[model samples]
Structure formats: C-alpha cells, structure tokens
Target: MTHPIPIFIGVDPRERAATNVLIDSLTQNSSVPLAITPMVTPQLEKQGLYWRDRDPKQATAFSFSRFLVPKLMGYQGWAIFMDCDMLARGDIAELWALRDDQHAVMCVQHMHEPNDTVKFLGEPQTPYPKKNWSSLMLLNCSRCRALTPEYINRATGLELHRFHWLAGDHEIGEIPGGWNHLVAVQDPAKAEESPLLHWTLGGPWFREQRTMGEGLAAEWFAARDDAFRLWD
Candidate 1:
C-alpha cells in the first residue's frame, strides 16, 4: 500500500498573504498529493500572552507546542513541515523518500555563521558550532509523535531567566541539511544549488522579487495563479 505523504505549512491570521503565496508556490511545484496545515498559536487569542511575555527567545515555541506537536501526533505516515515563507522549486519526491527511513527527521543546517546578525535583540551568541534552520522539516510522523511531546515539554519548561538556552532542539538524527535553505544569510555560492529556498527574513511579497541569488521563486510565482485556483 502507498502511504500518505502530507505537506504541512503553518500560518497565523496575521500572515494570511504570505501564507497564500507559500501555498500557491507549493502547489505549482509539487508533483505528489500534498496537504497544507496552518500553524496557529493560542497566544494570538490572549492579549499580552505573546512569546516575548515569557522568553523572547521562545518566540516560536508556543506555535510548535500548540499546533505542530499535536498535528504530528495525529497524522499517520510521513509529513513535510514547510514554513510559510518557503518556495518549492522541484519535485519533492526525494523528501518523501527520506521519510521512509525509520530513524531520520529531514531538515537543513542553518547557513549563517554562528554570530551572524540575525540573532535575537538581547540574546548572546550561541556557543554551539552552528545552528540548523527549522523552516523545512520532513518527518516520519510515527517517530515524531513519539518524541514531539517530550521535546515540547523540555522547550516550554526552560527558565525565562536562562534566555540563551531557549533554542529548540533541531538535532533529532541523520537528516540532510539541504531540504531547508536559509536564503537571507545563506552563502550565495551554496544557495545556488539548493532545491528549496526559504525566505526566512522577508519573502517575495514584501521584497517585490527574489534577492538571495537566482532561485526557484520566479518559477514558483509563475505557476502560482493556476496552482492557487486549483488548491482553492
């Protein structure tokens, strides 16, 4: 039997436009059947309950806790979690193939040097070798559901006092780093060959065009109109 391979994307009501652009791009390039799941955080409903209220570094933690973990637990088979800012350039069959492995959680390494300027406003430089981008992740849902809760609990329980310790654990196991490309801070030379471009900082809508070297964005945008109509 062929297992289901679903593609998930998260979006808040505030980011509807970017979300639409992302979905349009994915539909255009995707050859396999895909599912888009929006990421919503409970903090958005409660005033003054923002990530900054707890740990500024944990800005994205609640979204993962409230939405991603639960969704993965319920989803059977393989799922690809693509950030709302990513544009797919080619067939994602390789990503689906990776999910067949029992011990792997597909992901990409962060291209920015450890001390690159994008670090949080008041956060200290990371002592670790470097960080990985969380923008695109492919997982065997069965394996992820087993560990998602534990990871979420650990991330949520970190003391607000230890601000620098708030980074999410991206090192699950032997997943490739090419799946998630960090466009802005990525090395231009390296990005030239990446399959997926993640508009981590600002996407095409805000910038009016692709800027982080030539990438799949143009093709993705070209196909958007038809793809969006079909997906809708």
Candidate 2:
C-alpha cells in the first residue's frame, strides 16, 4: 500500500468553515491516505512560528503560512501545500501520484491580473509575477531548504510569492491547469475540467458573493452540501 501524502493547507481563522469544506472535498475524493494539516495562526504560534512578526499588517492571514509547509515537513522528502479556499473536483491521489524529483516544486503556472482592486475583507488585491502559483504546490521538501522558519520570518510576502526562494524560474515544474482553476478568471467550460477549484476572492462563506449566485459557485455549493450531508 502507498503511504499517505502529507498535505498542509493554509487556513485563516476567519475562514475556518470554508477550510473545513475544502478538507472534506479532498478527503471525499481521494482513495489514497492523506496526512492533512491546517496551518492556522494560533497553531503556528504554539509551534514557535510567530507569523505576525513577519507581516505586521496582516494583509493576508495565510500569506506566509504557505512557506512554512516545507519546513513543517522537516525539509525531507516531498509534500503538498494548498490554500484553504479550494475545492477538489477530482481525485487528489492523482495529483499526489505526480512526483518529479528534478524540481524543488511543482505548481500550476498562472499569468493572471486582478479584476477587482480589493480582496474578500477589502484588502488590496495585489498582483505580481507568477500569481496564484503558490496557491497549490507539490513541494520537493529536501530541495526547499530556503523555506526555513528563520527565512520565512524575515522574507517579505512579495519575495515569497514572486518565486524568489528558488535560484530561477526553471526550478519550478508545471502542473496541469485543471489542478487549479481560478473561479471567475477561467472560462466556464474549461474550468469544469479542472480537478481543483480555487475561490481566490471569497467562497460561499462570503454572504454577498453567495447571494450574487455566480454559476461557477454551484460546484462549490454541491461540494459543501455533500461535505455536510451528515450534519444536515
């Protein structure tokens, strides 16, 4: 039997419910075992990772947490990191099956621009090179020594998100776009084919956005319903 994959998810306390839904989607679809960990601020604090010292502004709650994934795995073997606001539409085991020892990290490369000026909590929607690339990553932990707690505690968000940790762009392996379909940014038909759906702006938890009733949201809603079927 294959060993369970270690998957760390960036979770903000404000979006705990959404994070839970994301977890449900991952667990429900994957046949392979998974060791899932949610990186929340309080938990990080207990682990001696004071994230706020790095981003005093707290612009994005989980902005720096993604960097901690490699370190959390003890800089050994391979692991995966994903944002909490994502839903899996396909087998996560398939994504786990992909492991290229050649690269330090594997991610869906996205050339994206923001349609809005602000994010879910009215924070500025900052765009930079290789946007959304870090949202979902297949990390080769041994090669990701640069993501140490000391380094992450001092590095700026821009430095982390802009692929500065690696020696160059070539170090990053590309994954299929279907692994990270950005809602609203992608074409509806094409998005349907994606195994992973990222609600970058705000998911169903956002009252106003939920009421707006975007067509792409139906999948998330369905996943949410299935996730909570026992409770309902």
Candidate 3:
C-alpha cells in the first residue's frame, strides 16, 4: 500500500482563534491528507528549551525550530509550514506535488513591489528584494530537522523589533519564490490568480473597521465558525 502524503500546519497557541480558522479552512477545503499541529512555547519554568523571553515573534520561530520540525523528521513525506493567517484559495495539492524534485523547501517571493514602502525601526524601508517567501514554507521533513536548530538560534539572536532587515539571507537556505505566493502586495490583477493569500499588513482580525477586500472576509468568518465547532 502507498503511504499517505503528509501536510502539516503550524500554529502558536497564543493565536487560538486565528489558528483554529486556518485549520478549519484546510480540513474543509483541502483534498489531500493533512495534520494540524499547534506549536506551543513551553513556559520558561515548565520545561524544555526556552528562547529567552516569550517575545511572540521569536517564540514562534523557535517553536518551529525546537519542536515542530524535529517531530516531523521521523517521517519521509512532504510538509508545509503555514502561518495562522494564510488562507488557502484552492486545493493546496499542487504545492505538494512539487516535492518530487529534491528541493529542501519551496516558498513564495517577498511581494512588496518597487513603489511600496514600509517603515522599519523608524526608517523608511522597502522589502528585502532577495528573501524568498517567509509567510508559507514547504519543507522536506528530514532536511528541515537538520537545519532548524541553527535557524532558530540565529533568528532568536536578532532584535525582534528589527526583523525586516535582520530576517537574513534566504538564499543561504530557502527554496525558490514560486511555491509560496505572497499575494497581498501583488498587483490587483495578479493577486486574483494566486493560490494562497497572505494577509501581510495584519491578520483578518486586526482590521477592525474594514473587511478583507473581497469575499474573503466572509469566507474567513465561515471558516472561523467551523473552527469553533472543533472545540465543541
């Protein structure tokens, strides 16, 4: 018998509602076999490796490094590490099939275009032109376990507030841009064709006044309702 392909989603428990919505969306829409893993940061006093204070951002990367990636290493299948805010536009199986190549990971390009600018550490900044996608990443489990610890250590050492610049060289160890499409900043015409839509500015919940541009906000609400059912 052929072993089932395994797809994994990671969530930090602190963002419970968002994470639940993400998992619900995948289960209800995805045709492939998948697993939702909540990546929790153990309290400093409780046990295991602690990455200094629980700075939410650092804690997130560290959880992937110290826990999630290693746990999946035992398996010989493909894995996708999705952020809680990523909502799938269609079947993600297209991405899974790309694993046939020996690439360690596949990601989208950073989407901020030439004219778009962001402020970083009080200075005007443009997106790092080189970093492959960071929002959604697909990794070979075996390869990830080998590099996760070092990635985590290096990521944690950087000042959390300055993440945009300190995010570091993606070419040193990340896949090409096509796999994880950073859709939010793409031109409106191009955005419509992307498979995954990442909420770059902030998550769905963060926009208290405006809804997510199109029908997506409604879709997110429906997914969130389904997620609540999982707990019940």
* Residue ranges of candidate 2 with Cα displaced over 4 Å: 54-59, 211-213
Off by over 4 Å in 1: 1-4, 42-54, 59-63, 114-130, 145-154, 157-177, 207-232
Candidate 1 residues 1-232, lDDT tens each? 4444566676645446667767766665666666666655553334222332344444343334332433354745666776666666656766677654534354555545555434322333332333433456665565544344444444543321122232334424445555676665566566566667676555555444443334545544554555556542
List the candidates ranked by TM-score, beginning with the highest. Answer: 2, 3, 1
**Predicted candidate 2 versus true structure: per-residue lDDT over 96-206, tens digit per residue:** 888799999999998888777787777678777888899999999999998888888788888888879999988999998999988877776877578988888777777
The best candidate in terms of TM-score: 2
Lowest-lDDT window of 10 residues in candidate 3? 158-167
Q: How does each model score on lDDT? A: 0.51, 0.83, 0.50
**What does candidate 1 score on TM?**
0.65
Estimated TM-score per prediction?
0.65, 0.93, 0.67
Cα RMSD to the true fold for all candidates: 6.0, 1.9, 5.8
**Cα lDDT for residue 159, model 1?**
27
Local accuracy of candidate 3 as per-residue lDDT tens digits, 155-229:
533321222322243422444343344434445455556566655443455445136535555656766766676
